[model samples]
Target: MVWVRLPVYFYKRNDTFYFSRSIPSDLQHRFNKRKIEVSLRTKSEAKAAKSAAALSDRLERYWDSLRMEMIYSRELGLKVLQDTKPCTTSEYSLSDALALYHRLKGGSKTKLFYDVSNRSIRYLEECLGHDNLTSIEKSDAGRFRDYLFARGMSSSSVKRVFSSVRAIINLAIREQGLVITNVFSGTFIPDDGAKQQRTPIPQDALKRVQMVCQTLDDEPRWLIALISDTGMRLSEACGLLTSDIHVDTVKPYIELIEHPWRRLKTASSSRQLPLVGASLWAAEKIIKEGNSFAFPKYCSEAKCNSNSASAALNKWLKPRVPAGCVIHSFRHSLRDRLRAIECPADIIDAIGGWTTEGVGHKYGDGHTLSVKYRWMEKIAPKVRELRSEETVT
Candidate 1:
């Protein structure tokens, strides 16, 4: 691209630039350093340059007015800058940011983030479709907060939406170096202050669900068993392959290896879970199929839908499980069983793939099969004992 600077005069007042009648304000800073001849094609070209210069002059005066307001109030200065800073080439609209975020995640995380963020984006578009990143003020954020409240969205739900927005803005700032601040700071998000709920399935409920799974024709019976037995997340279980299992070893265990393209939701989510009893049996059956996958073809597919698995479970197994219990309740059920067996917190954290307490350490490194298996054995009997107790009651 051939670059040329037009002859222009600029005066700097209070750290702002005002330009003469032949240069764009965008070009004013450059024009001040040197003068260059413009190859004007026609009178029309000259007129266009003159008009741009006039517009720059007007904008500079408007900026001066805002700066004068800033002299009395630092808040006003910040507000003006927040409203006027240009969106960088890479900085995108809320919708665009969400699309990029999903594209980057690419796997099960893409689906999870999309499902959660879509509702929030829809609300944001309705509230501020015309407003760019630079135009989004605290009042606008507060207005949306009120709108969510009116819609009966709980405080936690509103906070989730706010967090989604904050994440998008932070991503833009980090990746694109956008000159926008996180406007979500200091906003009054509602807090219902209810106690946190962590209701795992009771032992009787799990056995009833397992019994229902036995009668179903679905091939994922072992998948459910793996979750209940090993306390692996659905994604982790789904991502497992035949190579990840060591069934023939003296002490059988599953290796929670990380892949280049895929990631566990958290580092702690990557840890070994012992293969024994039903879980080991399931792993062996899957490995014997000659396919590399430990689960069925559909479960391992990149675009695999959990709907069928979920539907089958809900239809047959959910009724057996306690009301409001979900597939994830299996992890909770396993955790509760660990607590009942007096498993140490570190051991429990390792078996269930939970992050360590406090800040520095987030996840447990792989534990030995014997160590993990002991916990599983403890868990299996506890589950059976709970079922027996419930039957007696």
Candidate 2:
């Protein structure tokens, strides 16, 4: 005869001692407190009595644990049991977690995740294509790292894929209650890591980009000036609406508040950027015209390619801008200008939507434009001076 310890309750059925285990107090609390009938199926009265005694002891232990402040351990045990129990529905799968993640994210964020996850998933599929979640082991992750190296992927690239895969597994464990440990945790992938590179264009190069944007027919050309001056990400610039631009005063600025359906990549990225020099003028022209978005009409929306902006810049303005200058080079150029003028790192970080100090250093909470513009005013003159020198050269 097997006995399980559970809370005890009684029912008056046919005037007999019909003893059964009650639901756990926490679970019962979820329902209204009311009399409920329960039945204990036992062959003999002695077995029923033993069962009732065991249930009573269990309830007493539960109350004692609560009084002794061991609720955390009890809750953890309950969670483990809940996780290990057979699913009322089909067991959750890795694919199910991915689907849930997609469903939870908005369209723009979903697209971003898709872009990053696509390559990661491909690498995972190549390594563990046939393996289910239950079959994955630490050796499998190690083997995947080996495969990445064999395929000639850089250490940084492999690390990125590994991180993404770990994230996928974590989401599964957290959201789906999958009975699996994260295999990638504490595992060190070799890193033939390259130095973190910043590709900021020099002052001469920036002048050329600006000159190109000025001559080009496309409206997004102004976006080039904005990015060059403000150091906003291409996506942030692309997502910009006219409402975000404030230009009534001498000190004009763009508010990089929350995007409609997109969260900033980092908290620091959600800041305002002040407009100055040619960039300010260009933005003003666009805003004054009453267009809702700064880059409303992407040249080719069919494929939703951001490279089209770069392509347009390259085709029309290559001659004017310096060699090896991309659209993002403008941000680099701005950062360089700030460094030259000896602006405070915090001020520069705040303006550039980079959290490079204190809390931002630890967890990357981005700064505001008000903080950035204080430094922008100092650096803007140097940038203009360099542009003038370039023309003379």
On lDDT, the leading prediction is 2
lDDT tens string, model 1, 60-175? 56446445665666654443344344444312456566666666654556456777767776676444422235446577779888878888778888888888877766776677
Worst 10 residues of 2 by lDDT: 29-38
Local error of candidate 2 at residue 137 (angstroms): 2.6
TM-score of 1: 0.66
RMSD of 2: 15.9
User: 50-122 in candidate 2: lDDT tens per residue?
Assistant: 6456445544564464445446756667432433444421234445556665666535663667877656765
Q: After superposition, how far is residue 335 of candidate 1 from its true place, in Å?
A: 1.0
Worst 10 residues of 1 by lDDT: 33-42
Off by over 4 Å in 1: 1-111, 114-119, 171-181, 193-198, 212-218, 259-262, 358-366, 381-393
Counted clashes in each candidate structure? 0, 6
In angstroms, the error of model 1 at 305 is: 3.6
